[model samples]
Target: MRDFIGRAMMTLYFTVCATLKSGAMIVALRDPTWSWARGISVAADVAALGFLVLIVATTVARLPPVKTAQGIEPRLSALIGCFATVTLIAVPGVQTLPQLELVADLITIVGFTLCIWCLWWLGRSFSITAQARRLVTAGPYQLVRHPLYACEAVVLFGIVLRNPTWAVVAIGAIVICFQCRRIINEEKVLRSAFPEYDAYARATPILIPSISTLRELVFPGAR
Candidate 1:
């Protein structure tokens, strides 16, 4: 029953995030500028939506017991809310003259690459609230415990580079803080569910890459 609720809520969350990002991408594509930034933005959205769909589609029966779940308490709180579009929605659509648009485009490609592949590594174990179906130690996981959030940070930074506004900066800061809280929330449960998680974390950086682990590749040897 708890797993049922967890699956449903996570499905809803990822679906909504993908839907919003799809809408934003549609708007960006309509631009006649034929801009490379718009193209990269579209690719990013596609990768993100594809990954989100994969996460939802892969949720199956006979899964491992979830020792921890988020949003199962049925209480509304700021901590429970996820900033799904902190990377995509804050600056939806291409600006007529966005700052650092090219650099942002490149970053978008790099980020979504990390994100999509990390999801691949995570496979069916992925959840919005850190449900531990499996403890992945291969691929990007070897470099960072929360590879998804790490990729997201880079993606959000790219958006900030393009927007470069006080408003965007504030939103990014808030989003980062929210993510930090989420990490703590997730780790608490992970520690209980997976005994080796502490050692894995000790060996892996939280969001940043350790040179030893990261030398595997900038985006991981996988796609």
Candidate 2:
């Protein structure tokens, strides 16, 4: 069937991507040039690798969606946003202050860890395209509607910081634009599929969490 083929292809795509990236990172970590910066970078790579493996696993195990966007645009947006940052790997690293690179590595490590947490909550609902599998409103989703994408944005920003080049910045900006489009398309699909999604969106911020939102999440009685 066509649907079965699509799912198989998707699984293959994610599997190849995760395997290659993880292998490269593992090899890099094995290099004998150990330093504080390298250690931090290794941590970031490990977190990133974990996230990638999770993505492949979730993609293979995710539930069937109730509704899927019915256009080429949504698929294109999702694919672009998902893979855009990969170009940064080819960009030459710039010579920067060791402290600055270390800060960027720390930021990526934190972002990737949060991303993994978000993905854990997403679980069976994960999809590369705009599709509504189930209404997830727990964990990081309680604070922000698209916490996964927000965390990914953090990782992308950290990568840009690590490789401060005009091409990197331009690609980052383009990727962000596509990511925004992907978010919009996903919201539309979710709202169409779930009647309660509108109310949830109203209560939760889209990407950024405010101070009041943090307080409410911490102390539910405050609301």
Best by lDDT: 2
- Which tens-of-lDDT digit does each residue in 1-223 have in candidate 2? 6545666777776667667667767777779888988888778777777887787788778888899998899999988877776445323346788988999889988988999999999999998889999999999998899999899888888889998878888889989999999999999999999999999999999999888989876898796
Worst 10 residues of 1 by lDDT: 72-81
The residue pairs that clash in candidate 2, if any, are none
Tens-digit lDDT track for model 1 on 43-152? 76676667666666655432664675456431221224244333344346446354467777678668767877887787777665545677788888887888888887
- RMSD to native, candidate 1: 4.5
Against the hidden reference, what TM-scores do the models get? 0.76, 0.91
Cand. 2 TM to true fold: 0.91
Off by over 4 Å in 2: 86-95, 219-223
